[model samples]
Target: MKRIAVVGASLAGVRAAQELRAQGYDGGIVLIGSEAHLPYDRPPLSKAFLAGTVSAASLELLDAGDLASLALDFRLGVRATAVEPAARRVLLSDGGSVHADGVVIATGGRARTVPGWSGVHTLRTVDDALALRAALVPGVRVVVIGAGFIGAEVASTCRSLGLDVTVLEALDAPMAPVLGPALAAVCARLHLDHGTDLRCGVSVTAVGPAGVHLADGSLVPADVVVAGIGMTPATEWLAGSGLTVSVGVCVDTGLVTSLPNVVAVGDVARYGGRRHEHWTNASEQAPVAVANLLAGRTSRTYSPSGYVWSDQYSGRLQLAGHPSPADTFSVVDGELSSSSFAAVWQRNGETVGVFALNNAKLFNRLRRPLRRPAVV
Candidate 1:
């Protein structure tokens, strides 16, 4: 490939560009981004950044020195209008086009929002975090919708700021879709112990300037409303591109799309009918996507063992590998009551995943074992 275009310019896009250079591909690299600022980490936006413990400049993935060394044609604050596969060119919102031998789609995703709720807020970028943080002063009545990772972290940060924080969830327990009811129930205790008003198994009818109205006719008073519900892939621009897009851009095992010399990565790429919306997945997929692009075949297949972590209170909760609802879980070390422990998840008498709380050493050790094939 003589020239390459990488869309999104986030972690995956930047990493793909770096890998292409590291592999001795001295082609012209163009990194296009929708956001105005340089690529930054999103994980910290809901935690340290929102808490004011970290500065905005600290989130950047590439510094001046790093950008200078990469020699990338960085295009910031521009959107990709469409992809012309036959022409092998990308249409931009500014009536411009980029002709390249290969293209990497890493547009990532945007925060899902509630309709007609102009009074609420959602965090998906550094700018969003800054705006939300400004409203999170002490004594502010904050109502956070959805008890997922984003919601939990926002609630934790709000509590630290002495804000009256309340978390609402439609499910019976927090993160039940990923951790199951039993584990989610245990995790929900973290918010309760930290002085958060966590209400589960409740539906929100509407959200106005006044507060959150529940289906039961109860209202949760709030000075500020934050929505951490979920996110949808930024794939609207791909409409009529002749690519199979469901919840995200559909890709094969090699992360290659239906279009020739084109591949998708990060939260935007849905492989094997699954979307792994975590940092580790994006970092791992970028290199493989780069390899496939250069080799002109499925030289590598992306398989994630699944790793995710959350910060709540003084505890660091981590999970590795795929833990399904049918998996059997048992305490391997420490105690849940004491807030420091490790749990092993097994399927058909074979280890498949591990969950740890404030136990990094054990968590790291168990991760490798989960990657091995199940012993029948």
Candidate 2:
């Protein structure tokens, strides 16, 4: 392939371009991004960046030296409207098209916001974070809807700023499905322990300049409201593009789409019926996807590490492997109530998942078994 077009200049796209160069493919690369800013780290957007501890420049993934070495044709602030697989052309929003030998779709996703709500915040991009950060003044009342990872992090940051914060969750136990009941309860306590008004199993009816209106007709007065519900994969542009798209652009185990010359990655890709929004998943899929794309077929199947981490309050929570509510939970070290512990979920005799809160050392040790490659 003489030229390859990588859509979405975020983590997955940048990594794919880097992988191409690392694999000795010194061909032309066109890296396209919807956002005007350079590709930057996103995990920090909800944590340190929101807390004012990190600078905007510090979040950048590639510096001038790195960009020069990669020799990428960087196209910033442009959106991919459609893909013509047969012609190997990508239609952009700016009335232009990029014709390449191979195309990589890594458009990630966009934050979901409440309808009929104006001026309410939803954190996804750097621009969204900046707007929310400006609204999060000291002594302001912050109401964060949804108790998922992002909502919890926003509440934690608000508390850190000495602002009045409240977190609302539709589920009785936040993240119960992912972390299981035993561990999720531990997350609940962390909020209360930090003086956050966390209400569970509540339904929000509406949000406005006044505050968040509950299903019970009660209003949680707030100067700032942030909806951390979830994100919708940015696949609207790929409509009628001849690629299978459902929740996201559907791809096979090798990250190859319906078209052999095109592949999807990151949050925009629903691989093997699952879409992972984790940084590790996006980073890990790039090399394998690039390899398969260059080979003109599925030469390598992508193996997920199932690793994800979150920073909340004053603790670091880490998980490896898939942990479901049905799995048998066991506390291997420390206690969950103490804010520092290591635990595991097992099915029969095999360790299926591992979790740690503020206990990275033990977490790493326990995660070793999960990271081992299975024998053929």
Candidate 3:
């Protein structure tokens, strides 16, 4: 009970160490991460950092001085190979072992790389942003291979530099899966309005030195391409760990795995209480996991309510709650393409999900005091 080891070394791991210290724990804390760099915010790698407006040095989660004061040993560039529950230790790929009273898995996720698109780059870290930012020059022809949050922001960054940008989406519309088909159309229109050549429902048949060849035999000429097709959780190392492993590391409300003294967090954690693919969930889960681990208890509970937000040019998007299976929705405010608006998703006469697009004030107003009733 005098020492704890936290794996994954991203937002969740960093927060977990901080929370343990805050919970009045005076023990040896170790944060293990596969990345050589310390925990850094991943969102801006596609936006501000790609536009050359932000620097990597500003993205660090904990400074060296903070690390020193916290008395935390950061095991950077170390990949955890296995979880030895019986021994209360972590086996690392680099032939090392970390013994601890508790372990937290905050391994985060990985960006899905596109094959045959050697010209395309995916942004998920400081290095990715730096490499992509180096190509952001005025009048450079660029093609973004998806129109999700990362792709949209990359296009935004390119547009700022007066680059000839084209966004190709295989889906009928961008952000439709999350924002609905109608509102996603609004986002499409915004891209076109800002001089982005958005081509949806088209697949990249080939990627090579010349340009991207389309399935319809059309060629889109570009000097560079960027793909942002989302990510897969970094939990493959736990393949033999004997815990639940779907697309993510399955965890419960207490953030516990079936394995004893172990918890998972961040995007890599699929909490059984609810979905947790959001920063808000990470903000909530880390402290809870740390508290339970420090207290040496097994019955503490915490729920992961999936919520995340995005900014596209002048527009702001906020998802406040989880959507229900039988959810029907109505736009309680402005039109999809117009000014401030909100979409209220309801299930059996109760609000289940709330989304505000360009409606910051209303979003803030409803950000608190709303909870989803458990589904039967």
Candidate 4:
């Protein structure tokens, strides 16, 4: 391949380009991004960036010297409007086209917004984080919608800044869908212990400039509201492109799309019928996607080493492997009261997952074993 066009200049796209060069492909590399800024880390946007502990420059994944060394044709602030699979070209919003032998789609996703919510905010970009941070001054009333990873982090950051925080969730417990109700209850208590006013099993009817209106006709007074409900794949540009896109761009085990000479990675690529929205997943898939682009059918197949972590109130929670709702969980080491422990999830007498709280050492040790097909 003489040239490769990589759509989305985020982590996955940047890693793919790096791997392509590392694999000895000295072709013309074009890294296209919708955002004006060069590729920057997204995980820190909620924590360090919002807290003003990290600057925008520190979020950059590649510096000027490194970018210059790569000799990449970096196209920032341009959106890829469409992909012509047959012609092997990407159409940009600026009325330009990039022709390449192969294309990598890593557009990722954006936070889902609630309709008619004028004052409510969602954090998914650097700009979003900065705006939210400005509103999170001391003594402000902050209401965070949803109790998922992003929501919890936002609440924690708000509390750290001496703001009064409240979290609203439709489910009975935080992260009930992922950790199940039993363990999710433990996570719920974590927030309550930290002075978070958590209201579960409640529905928000509407959000206005005044505050969040509940189903029971009660309004939670909020100076600033943040929504971390969820995210939707940024795939609108792929319409009529002959690519199968459900919740995200459908890709096979090898990360190959339905269209020819094209593959996708990161939060935008739905591999094995599921889109993993974790940073590690993107890092893992990049090398595999690049290999397939260079080696065609001879490339390695992708197998997800399921892993995710969250930070809240000086404690860290980590999980490895996949745990279904039907899986049985058991505390194998430590205790929840101690705030440091390891738990294992089993299904059909086989270990399927492992979780740790404030136990990074044990979490790292158990990751490999949890990833095994059969762990006794």
TM-score of 2: 0.98
Backbone clashes in model 1: 0
TM-score against truth, every candidate: 0.97, 0.98, 0.91, 0.96
Choose the strongest candidate by TM-score: 2
For model 3, residues 1-376, the per-residue Cα lDDT tens digits are 7778988777788888888888888989888988898788777777777777777788887888877778888788989988877788888989999997788888888889766667778887788788888877666799998999888888887887889999999999997877777778878987998899999999998888887889999999988888888887888788776788888888766777776577877888786533456667777787777766765565567754556787777677788776754579788888776757887778777776788888877766664546533221
Candidate lDDT values, in order = 0.88, 0.90, 0.79, 0.88
Locate the minimum summed-lDDT window of 10 residues in model 1.
367-376
C-alpha lDDT of residue 177 in model 2: 80
After TM-score superposition, what is the CA distance of residue 8 in candidate 2 from its true location, in Å? 0.5
Which of the numbered candidates is closest to the native, going by highest lDDT? 2
lDDT (10s digit) by residue, model 2, range 134-173: 8887789999999988999888888999999999999998
lDDT of 3 at 369: 45
lDDT of 1 at 314: 72
Model 2: pairs clashing at backbone N, Cα or C within 3 Å: none
Judged by TM-score relative to the true structure, which candidate is superior, 2 or 4? 2
Per-residue error (Å), model 1, residue 298: 1.2
Residue 129 of model 4: what lDDT?
Answer: 97
> What shift in Å separates residue 225 of candidate 2 from its native position after superposition?
0.2
Q: Could you give candidate 4's per-residue lDDT for residues 152-240 as a string of tens digits?
A: 99988888888899999999999988888767887888889899999999999999888999999999999999999899999999998
Q: Candidate 1 clashing pairs?
A: none
